[model samples]
Target chain A: MASNWEEFYSSHPQPANLSKNEDLLRDFTARHLNGDTRVVLVTSGGTTVPLEHNTVRFVDNFSAGTRGSASTEYFLDHGYAVVFMHRVKSLQPFSRHFTGQKFLNMLDLIETKDGTSVTVTSENIPKIADVLRKYKSALANGKLLELSFTTVYEYLWLLRSACQILAPLKEKCILYLAAAVSDFYIPPNEMSVHKIASTKPQTISLQLVPKILAPLVSLWVPNAFVVSFKLETNKDLLIDKAREALNKYKHKLVIANMLQNYRQKVTLVTQQSSYVIELTTEQSRIGEEIEMYIVKNIVDKHEEFIADRSGRS
Target chain B: MASNWEEFYSSHPQPANLSKNEDLLRDFTARHLNGDTRVVLVTSGGTTVPLEHNTVRFVDNFSAGTRGSASTEYFLDHGYAVVFMHRVKSLQPFSRHFTGQKFLNMLDLIETKDGTSVTVTSENIPKIADVLRKYKSALANGKLLELSFTTVYEYLWLLRSACQILAPLKEKCILYLAAAVSDFYIPPNEMSVHKIASTKPQTISLQLVPKILAPLVSLWVPNAFVVSFKLETNKDLLIDKAREALNKYKHKLVIANMLQNYRQKVTLVTQQSSYVIELTTEQSRIGEEIEMYIVKNIVDKHEEFIADRSGRS
Candidate 1:
């Protein structure tokens, strides 16, 4: 049998930067608590399972961190403090809008007598300015805290530390787990110390990674309204799997999505009901992202959850 | 025993875009051939082995495509027309220097009563201009042609198509195989049609990928000076493994490096001798990339090879 999450953590060494990141999170959370702010931890991107300690190769999930990054901005717009934990070099909130060759395409290099200068092209200035204004304001107000991780080990360590810090806030916090974490991994004790050589036929055996949600929901931040994502390629199985996860973890909700149409549609699965949200063809053509709708719905639910808890107390 | 390269290609389906890319390559090659230009096909990044047809997850080699992208620029500087074949979204020649959050950091957004505008900061303008100028010139002069692939299947199909297009050029063509291709893969026939469900423990079986260099050197573009890279984490076996590859493939050179030190140093292995080339710490600190030296050495060897061929004829 595979080790459970607790055993996995005890056996594996904590990431070297975990303590430093925890300290940063502590300060950020403390500041928010004093102001009676609502906080959301948005975990994004894909976690990699390294095959070796020296790691020349890894098992990776397909994710651009589009969902998490996009949702973080919307959360901030709704006046929620966000802990943006994401894969390093994956899309980031403001930077996501300008990544790849898009940034270069948006700029015009002008040459004058003195020298050359690069500026956003006239047609692109409005959109860039809008994103930049929101980004700068978030930073200035310290409402957004950014942290990054690469390997699965680092992500697990940082997640636990973040949860530990958020525990005191209880019902005031929401755990929006959007990251596509690895399902299997070669444990630290089994991974190669060096790169696996290509000189011979190789068999790599990876064990199922213990489900972190087990500890996360049950112990780490028990009172936090936790929402997890369940992505499947089969439409028929999507809602069923999501509902199963919600039942097992006893979390607030599970966002179900089919891999093919995730960008345009998703289903919100709760214990009592499941609702589908989709973007119309016209809306997609006009560049309205599905994340906007998803975030809005989530915010409403989170608010209702807070109200219910406060009434009971 | 594993199947040879020829058998593997015969059994596999051709990448959907292979024929389209071949048309582009054919046209590009004809133009260069008429101009008497030396052409280098630089393969960059890492090919992925998808677990399913929908590809929610993959086994990926750890590479940012730095070696291939940086070297392409140097090759271009030395007046070689380049066919830059790379993994989708991996680094590319001029654009690489500005990727990630670097582009955002190098700019400033200014607001006025009229509107807001973004411009490259004065300190960063010159460097950005130089890179942009070179990138524009390359595209304008038809000196660079790019083709991108994601899966190992696409890489194999495109690679063979590219070689067929370059075959008529013979010795004037150089194959700089820098992409970190997978040594093992789950064939199309075996891959799941949808995403693999994480409902239970699953064991994936992968077969060794046939060595492409064998057919590449002996059949496709036989007269091209082919150089391959051998990346290993073990230092003691690096040179020996590189030499072994050279002997087996009958290729011109193998550039060997330890994964940890690859950015700073590489060992050039040829049939007669091997030589180590390394960058000084000061050079590295000053932002000098080792690709410049590697490309220079390869260019020198290529010239010698051309001369020797002419003498023999």
Candidate 2:
């Protein structure tokens, strides 16, 4: 046991891979020191799964990071310090000019079927589910975004940890929860040691894991501004889902979208009213509109809070 | 007669929004006069039909132009002269460091559909078909790539002229025939002034114009190194289509891909063998592989021909 512990201690494991985004973050932070640099946290690309070998497993998503990364630059030009948390293997390298954490682990999990109502202790369930469902076509096409995770437990762990890490920083950040996460994962009892051949009889159950980060918005980080996304196929359900998400996370804003045509079509659902931004008519301008809308809204909300605090003082 | 010609020219004047990309190209051309510099042309994004006052008639591909634009930077780094001809809304801004042509008029094809056949008369047919087929899923989901031409003759005339303009520069060009061109266009007799609606009549007869570029490839530009792409639904049919394309265009290489999971997977079909590049494995690394393969092959081919000429001398 002592030798085992010694071996663990003696073998110098490589330090964590440093992010290339540090320089970019430093420069951005430096620029915002004196200004009301609208700080926007944009997460781009698909999460990566590390395999047994140093290589990767499977990946999903085809974001190209165009919408997110390009919007970051646009936001910066419009005087915003963007904290871009990116997934690995995106087409454009995240400007190594910013400050952000890149969580490079595939979160895997195993859950009972939804009907069974099995209890799960995992975190960030909805976020992971959101990531998976929202980017369904992008994931299916296998274009720019790719992802791989063996189990749901690992995925939940990664998801919760990432949100938690960023949760504390939420005080100054506008959380753009755009990353899609998976809702279903393999159940612990049903998981196979090796690849399960079709010959094997296996019954898999999926249960909704309690959300790990949504509650945190109201419970732990009440001062932080939150914005979540709702992707639905039914138009009627979109606004309701967005409201549910907003109320649940207590977010200031929610972008709800029905599975519309691929041109970045979404409806902005705020506490006051709802607005739809159609990409069908203006496909090329979708990214610009989304980025501008999010940035302006966040900045405006932040300013109002600041003014309110000043007034009280 | 002179007044009529002037009136015609004034009525159909070219749009003057081509300066930014043109200037970049001029500056890029001027930068590398040392002869040690190599050039790479990157054409990206998609173009659309300008229609509405607030909105425009748009036709676009799934082509974010990521592959082409990203690889251009790589080529420029290795020292090469690039004349990039691009459509509207490309992924990257025409690199300020390269020679570029931002032509809004790529290939204007007037297409009408028969029971199972599509007739196109313009050179842009192939590109249009390619984009539509590439974004098949998105189309099914609702966002469609639509094109409307005033006349089939107009489309044919534009295509012919565009090819003629670029023919002389074929010697210095490495044509990356990534754009999907249509196989057929409508004939004059079949033309009609009806907007294609979602609910259509039971029957329609359409006459197809034979592919114009195929004949031009063999007759006009015999020395150019042309590469074409072949997309198929069946694995067995891929090589057959590839061979047909090669024979038709007399191209040196063809990238054959199947519509089955093709958005995520593709094969590099050359004269010798077919290589499948699994996009699921490495994200950014896959982009690297594509760049290396294209660049190395071009460089080697150029060097080999030069060596052969020297040996003959």
Residue-level error in angstroms, candidate 1, position A184: 1.2
What lDDT score is found at residue A192 in candidate 2? 42
Candidate 1 residue-wise lDDT, B1-313, digit = tens: 3457777888878888788899999989988986668999999999998988898889999889899999999999999999999998888898888875677678778998987888888999889888877887788889999999998888999999999999888899999999999988886888899988776666677788988998889999899999999999888888889999988989999999988889999999999999999999999999999999999999999999999998999
Report the CAPRI category for model 2.
incorrect
lDDT of candidate 2 over B201-256, digit per residue (tens):
22222222344446446654454455566655446667777776666566667767
For DockQ, the strongest prediction is 1
Distance from true location, Cα of B201 in model 2, Å: 26
lDDT at B65, model 2? 46
Stretch of 10 with least lDDT, candidate 1 chain A? A197-206
Show the lowest summed lDDT stretch of 10 residues, model 2 chain A. Answer: A97-106
Candidate 2 segments exceeding 4 Å error: A1-41, A44-83, A86-161, A164-174, A178-224, A228-250, A254-313, B1-81, B86-162, B168-174, B178-224, B229-241, B255-313
For residues A96-133, write the lDDT of model 1, one tens digit per residue: 88765577677787888976788889999888878877
lDDT per model vs. reference: 0.89, 0.42
